[model samples]
Target: MIPDMTIGQLTTEASSRWGEIWDPRATRMTILLLCPRKERKMMELHGDMIEHGQPVMAVFHRPRAEAHLLEEQGFDPRAASFQFVNIATADMGPWMQQLVNNEGWLRSSIALNPTPFSVGLPSQRPFEAVQTLCFRHPSLPALEQYFLPYPAESLPGKCFVSLPRRAAAEMARQQAEVLGVGRLEKPQPPAPEPAPEPQPAPVAEAPSESQETEASEAEEPASQTPPEDTAEPPAEEHVSVPLPPTAKPDPAPAQAETPVPLPPTPGEASTESPAEDAPGDGELSGSENIDLPEVVEEAEEISELEVELRAFFQELIDAGVEPSAFMDDPRWEDISERAVAEGLETWPILLQMTAMG
Candidate 1:
């Protein structure tokens, strides 16, 4: 039904209404589908973005060749576990108009936990939760993953996956916990086999005490030794002990339970690159967007400026505004332009952040 709806998706032409998860952001209001890769069908959904009066985007697992396609369309696309991406950003207003007007569109975001359980939906009603869960479109693997053993009870028909942010945090926490537990359970070598053959001096001291008592008792002639020597080695202490206790817990420092890293935003490949501390680790990839210039100190300064400027502009980008509109506004452009003349080059960064079709 949204396929024919307009920006509010609730214009007078719309005869019916579907409930929406209350969100403050005016831009991203639409039903989300969690689905398998079905290019043709999803293109139809993109069509519906215009019809329904919502920006169209998708989350799917696939080859991801469509990344730049969405990127060019001004969508925020993200890669999850090398398989999935949250694609489509330009789903509102003129872009939507062009979609309905001329017709079409395209990609960002954190990784979601890849399991049956969703940590973020506990507060939601079962029906809402089902809709949220079922919103993922049915693909072969996703279908096989969710429906095989068949959680048939969970089908929130027609509802969207408006999973709350806490749910995302919970998902992150749960993922962190599993990874933590796995690292704790990993088999490790017994600690440096204790300076081989070095005598355990403590047991030696216990025997010395026992012998001195015997010697003093030998001097006491018979009385002390008779009652004491008769007592056995503390009944051999048959008390049970769990295996790991007292076994020097693998001397290696516990591997920290790091939550799966969140996916990168535009121009932020750190999440996608190798660990920062990876030794001899210079370049993560040949992507020119991240390449460094030759002059070490000077290039470093430019990189710093670039990073700062990009972040400052991300807010406008996320708002789905055009940089040219901001420039024409008179308030921001002069300051931005003057700053650019000072060698800041902030406008291009702003353009990349905002400019949409």
Candidate 2:
């Protein structure tokens, strides 16, 4: 049968087991055991005794661990001498239970009856497990409270610590930042850049001089797009890529047959909702083609009229128009020219006409 040693007897055995020859007065009564995994061996503690005024002890490492033990001056590799008999209660039940329950902790062949107090002995966390189990009360409230902030599985060697969600998110974000822009998805190659637009086949030089004159006038509208609507001018280093030819131009807008005269600023806004007037799912009927050009002309006419209309309305409000004279015989053509020169709209005249009739 294995000899059962009290915490005090372990002190004598620890010293004798090491074969330490010391003066009887110099033999340390207390010591720490330094073991790794299951290995052990011994050495004497003399410095702390001579220097710190503390009682010293004989220490050892498992013989099997002899080759692996460190021989540093102040380091104790084992606890071969310790008189733990004076320690009131030393139960290692909780520690053994914790180790068994926490499978990932270091392999611990727990003592059946803990007559030893190995407080200073080292393990993964020094003596935390042993001390915790020995001192921890068995009451449910005590157990629950003790385990609240830290679960046993979360103990270093224990693998059951589920990572907290916030910590996980932060870790993931940090990893993404480390990966940088290069490793990320490469923008799907941008649909092959659709191949630069075919430049209108350079307009087959017009056959006749008369046709050329018509061509010149037609060419003016192509360049007429407002500067604001086009893409911004490219900076020096970058070349401006013209839109690809694959995409077709938007179709002409539909409108009434006669040119719809511009509405006056003083007039209430047109009730038509822009969306209601927007084309829905299908192509316009063939009959609608006749009104297309007229619609385009009216649009061009509206653009020039917008600024004037706003200005003239302001003018008239300052110096009122004669209500009855507004309908005097004057063609819109003459009104158009003067309005063009003055940058005024037909709005003031329209308002007067409305007031007269």
Candidate 3:
């Protein structure tokens, strides 16, 4: 039977054996607990971590055989209690490792173990995927420690650990879809209202005095009275009478005619002065002064002495190398001067300098 040890004694012995493994400055620890299919045990472990003042993030991996049992228990993957990950066909080690790395290790220590599952035979070895993950982390517990009673029993094949809350939630979402279990529906945002269309302005109507005058003159002839009838004697019996000469009607005074204005032809200017014809602030006009080039532009022109050198500098920046490194180099002055003359060639000098990194 295993002997019980005092808490203080345990701490002392732990410090002596694994002191270097845990950084004292770390305020939190990201713990990976495997095969924690039951909710109660997970809660217990979480409380234990909290008591130690370790900010814990846990991922519970359930086997395919126990999935129905979880569903029957009314297990909600979206619950805030703990994170969930599916492990039916996919390996859990690499997935967990990726999560831990992405979440980062700067603030916490990391620990991996399997629990609450039955142990396999002593000859059994952990999964290679788990071992690989552990090997990459310098602060992780020794592989031999994982072969003990608890981890061996729960995580039989591998010993990879730790997860972030966001990563765990994402994994749970993906696993729900894979298992044919539908996800919870998130409420969608309402669409924006459409803009109102502009209406056309009303047009004004002109007066119709010309039409009214034409209509009145047309009816005047038809409305006139007939002349009275009179009979006269034959020309032989008629007497001729001399009449006084009639004065010619005075000529009507000539009226002046108003002149209609006409649009000017091309190549002719209107009567308006040149000042009036000049463009106002609202009108587009050409700028008189030319702006100087940007600093980068000037630098590029100076560097143009070298062929393909500018492109190399651009590629270096794109590849995440510091631009200042090249600029600050002692060779830059000579190279810049030579580039103006020789145009820096790609082959002999540039390749040699680049390989120095």
Candidate 4:
């Protein structure tokens, strides 16, 4: 029978027996409880660890067969809870060692029998009379402890443990059910809203021949009108007499042909100044119109950059890396700098994209 012990005692015992096999430089530790798959029991143990502030990273359900293979294959479980852990500490080895040492509730919760499993037994076989615990690390041998009195009729499942932020924990629960591991106790995530489709730029159409003709015809009447302030003699005042043929005998026909000037409009000035009629320097003329093409080109460039940024985030997701946790990676610096230069709200955009996913 396993003795009851506090978290500190469990840590000390584990360190003394397996310290040599532990890698101090490792950033993560995987703990597997080979107990019966009972939701109530799993929740009790998870809640106890949380109540004691044990840095619980994540908790989910998986087939016992699959959980056992994790140690041998070294494959990532892709649990979302691990995203909350800050893995960028300088002395990750010591930090992880400390984490292992503090898992007293974890040790007590699964400690069933004092004897380890016999060598060469197929791990795939159902637990007949014993339960086991495993502490797996990358590049290091796994540390295991055995427990007794595993009920024969208990279902075949294992509770997987890790850390999670509040929302991420809820998501993990949902994923566990969706993947057919946990009880169908949580609701699936709602379908994501579709992303807005990009609209094409407007194309400028050339004027047709008929439209050009109508425009030119509209301008002819305006051009024919006289200036508003100009004065001219009435048609009635310019009558020619029948004596016009004989009038050519006048002494000087040139003097007689001299035109008469008419009085200016009542309130108008007689003096003309070309400068007063022309457009001022401050006013934009037809030749000095805005450079609209350059503005449109800039907008298009920003749109393309946004698309590229979204694709970069998608690549991270596909690779099972959390976008928030990837900030310390070298590749992120370039992306961040470019985003800042373009005035993009990187985090907001990333969150929106991830929500859709």
Off by over 4 Å in 2: 1-97, 100-173, 179-186, 192-357
lDDT of 2: 0.34
Stretches of model 3 off by over 4 angstroms after superposition? 1-18, 21-60, 76-157, 161-357
User: Can you write out model 1's per-residue Cα lDDT over 160-209, one digit (the tens) per residue?
Assistant: 22222443445556677878843356687778755667766664334677
TM-score of each: 0.16, 0.16, 0.14, 0.17
Query: Candidate 4: misplaced stretches above 4 Å?
Result: 1-27, 32-44, 51-165, 168-235, 239-357
Q: Candidate 3, residues 208-296: lDDT per residue as tens digits?
A: 99988888998787677565577776567667899999999999999999998997665455545455657752253445354677776
Looking at model 2, residue 282 earns an lDDT score of 28
What is the full ranking by lDDT, best candidate first? Answer: 4, 3, 1, 2
- For all predictions, the C-alpha RMSD in Å is 51.3, 47.2, 41.0, 50.8
Please give, for residues 240-330, the per-residue lDDT of candidate 4 as tens digits. 7675454445475454567779876754543443455566643646558756664554544466667877888887888888766768667
Q: Which prediction has more favorable TM-score, 3 or 4?
A: 4
lDDT values of the candidates? 0.39, 0.34, 0.41, 0.45
TM-score of 4: 0.17
TM-score, structure 3 vs. true: 0.14
Cα error of candidate 3 at position 310, Å: 99
